[model samples]
Target: MSAAFFSRDIVSLPPSSPGMRIGLFGGSFNPPHEGHRLVSRECLKRLDLDAVWWLVTPGNPLKDHSDLAPLDARVRAARALVAGPRCHITGFEAAHGFTYTFETLSHLQKTLPGRRFVWIMGADSLAGFHHWERWDEIFSMMPVAVYVRPGSTRKAAVSRAASRFRHGRIDESDARLLATLDPPAWVFLHGLMSTLSSSQLRSRK
Candidate 1:
């Protein structure tokens, strides 16, 4: 499976409906698992999103490229795991030649200007978000919904971005309003946690 085969056919796909609230959950998906589904499902339930797009990246900039599985294999595995109408497994970002999460979100915002988009991420990613390229721009582009993974809540809350934008944290009750709110608004959702991780799964292979 190579990068060439994994890119998505974004142009041919129908445009998102007006007022559609979508969650963008981008990652390597080296091998998608229940955790991915749990997070997306929880976001859909709590954030009132119409769908969750699994933007499977060709590889993560922060991670070691050597360990990444081929993009096509990862896309197939992700499609197999997230088998649901509301959960879309796409290599759209890879197809568009966007490697970074921030860039992908920007592109999506422009491409689907009418639809509401919320950035979905795990607590651990939130904690290390500052390391991402143009991370602050992401906050300005759309609301971020952080799913609380076990052992990452406290540390993530104390992270630089959280502290810098302390005023952005919204109550769980207000989470569903995230898509409509201004950029920088975010919420930490406590949902069903899964211990599974791609790193651990890869190690076993």
Candidate 2:
């Protein structure tokens, strides 16, 4: 980590300020690959984001950790992938000790105040989002942008969060407006996707 980056309250995190459009993409990143970058690229172009931060989590509360790689190793693998000037990889959740999505976002908001934060996820996650801890609070905390995945589009659009917040759903054409919108606001984007995931990658070994 650079000395300048080490200056943040959240260790090794890149600098972001008020009014910047930042997309938060959180995950285990056990072996971050091109698929992750593909989504980031789409988010940057379509959402008009200033940056996309990959929140490399320490562990997933709902996932089995038996085959999970070390956090440092995962971060290193993610760092090896190509990213645009604005994209970043960070272990902030582990550095700052946050366990849940809602708590993580809340802490980031407090530390980096006045900035627009968008929760980025794949439609596959939406299908099972109801199982996350304090999942609804996550929706109410920031604007969300979910992109269609290879096999999860229909299931995601009909998900619990999708149904409950149906009125909050924004049209894809208006995606550029998400960063400035209030909480409970989200949009479902359709486009290119990768059939890759950490679990899938690990199973191949």
> What RMSD does each model have against the real structure?
1.9, 3.4
**What value does the lDDT take at residue 105 in candidate 1?**
81
Give the poorly placed runs of model 2, Cα more than 4 Å off. 1-11
Which prediction has the highest lDDT against the true structure? 2
lDDT of 1: 0.84
Model 1 worst lDDT window (10 residues):
6-15
Residue pairs that clash (backbone atoms under 3 angstroms), model 1: none
**Candidate 2 per-residue lDDT over residues 1-205, each given as its tens digit:** 3223432433477788898999999998888988999999999999999999999887889988888887777777787795557988888777666778888898988889999999999999999999999899999999999988998998998899999999899999999999999989999999888888877888889
What overall lDDT goes with each candidate model? 0.84, 0.87
